[model samples]
Target: MQTKLTRFSFIAAACLILAGCGFALRGDSSIDAKLQPIYVASDRESQELSSSLKRQFAINDVAVSKRRKEAKLIVIVKLLDEEKRSVALDREARDAEYALFESASIELQSPDGTNLRGPHTLQQRRLIVNDPDNPVGEETESTIVRAEMREQLSIRLARQVEFWSHQLQDQP
Candidate 1:
């Protein structure tokens, strides 16, 4: 019985490792994956952008350390707006459903920092925080929105990566 249990445990561990448990996980080993240790500009929005990019591309997708000379790409995202608008307004400008709009200009570059993909501004809009400040169900909604934005950003970044990757591949 112990032997059977031990064998099952081994199999389970193997499966988990093969599944990429708790390690760098990229959608694929694309050019973006090869360009590890990328640099992201310092800021909250940039942080989110970096985190999201890492998720889609690879862990440590956007390196924050300046001393890290190995970093090839430097991505800068400038926040344009973080506004709240009334969706369903009352007689006055009070007590109404609100919407949040966020806009940023995203730029990706080569190792020398030449423009590879954007400066193609992307905008993300969503509804206001409905759940006061409890921070419970807040995650569910925020996660959904973040996931959506991440998908959009990934598609754009992937296209850029593919373009550069193809260029390099065609060189020789």
Candidate 2:
């Protein structure tokens, strides 16, 4: 009975400590009201990133406007590029490892086209060790990694918008 009580006490204390530090789960990060009704405009080649952004915003309970004119804030994704290259070679000169790089050019603007935030470039990279014997598995792993990278990028973009929204709120 004493051991069980001690375990309960420890768990309660840990929870209190985490709360004191203001730690929150990733999904609990809330979007500011100023960024609601946002429009994400992306080039045809960047549809995946656009979809990721819209999903993130929806998760945060923010409505992503389908039309640019209906939104108070607009996120423009000018370009998204993906590149892969061999980083390591096997003994027989075959590719043993690959470096995957993805980058996007993004800008924030108002409905009137006034630049709110810069034309910034965000980049993400991953290194994958190849498996010559299991080529199909390697391809599937690469695809999953790319999807995760896109999700991470979407989170980053959402945080940027939240920061900008707070700054705007503080302005007179």
Candidate 3:
């Protein structure tokens, strides 16, 4: 009886050691293994964000205008601000350039049939301003700021999605 007890104890210790080392199967990622498709409305920034997400995750993209898209992960982005403040002046004391801060707000909802609405976020920020002296007009400067915001927002949303995807893999 003592010999059998000792053998069981050794086996249990070895199993614990293996578990502590994070030895688990790989195929199982998140409780919902089913590929939850992602879809987003076109708000310039959303378009960029959707493209970025598509590249990162194996998700199907659907048009927001389509009724079925409502069932999947839907995201909408609102261009919050695109302001520029005079940071410095030229030799003539003219408003040489402005320190621009670009901010965007996003709404993401993973519906009931698939995944519930996530943390209600997906935001991005960046500073962008055109060369005020490049002879570019105010319109051109505005365009540059919008473009920069789109690019930066795309990067931030992609990173957040990747992090969430990894979290899914670890949990039950």
Best of the candidates, TM-score: 2
Model 1 score (lDDT):
0.59
Q: Which candidate wins on lDDT?
A: 2
Q: What TM-score does prediction 1 earn?
A: 0.51
Q: Distance from true position, residue 153, model 1, in Å? A: 5.3
lDDT (tens digit, per residue) of candidate 2 on 105-162: 7788989999988788888889999987788988899999999988888888777777
- Model 2 gets an lDDT of 0.84
Which regions of candidate 2 fall more than 4 Å away from where they truly are? 1-5, 8-24, 27-29
Query: TM-score of each candidate?
Result: 0.51, 0.83, 0.51
- Residue-level lDDT of model 1, residues 1-172, one tens digit each, is 9999999999998989978766654454355445555665536756665565556554424333454356766666566665556677545545345565666666766667678766766677777545444446555766776567655664555455546555655665
Ten contiguous residues minimizing lDDT sum, candidate 3? 26-35
In candidate 1, stretches whose alpha carbon ends up further than 4 angstroms from where it belongs are 1-29, 32-37, 59-68, 91-93, 128-172
Per-residue lDDT of 1-172 in model 3, one digit per residue for the tens? 9999999999999999999999975331121334245554446644554554444344223223234344355555455565667766777776665666655555555554344335434444443443556656755766666566666565565455444645655668
Decreasing lDDT order of the candidates: 2, 1, 3
Per model, state how many residue pairs clash: 1, 0, 0
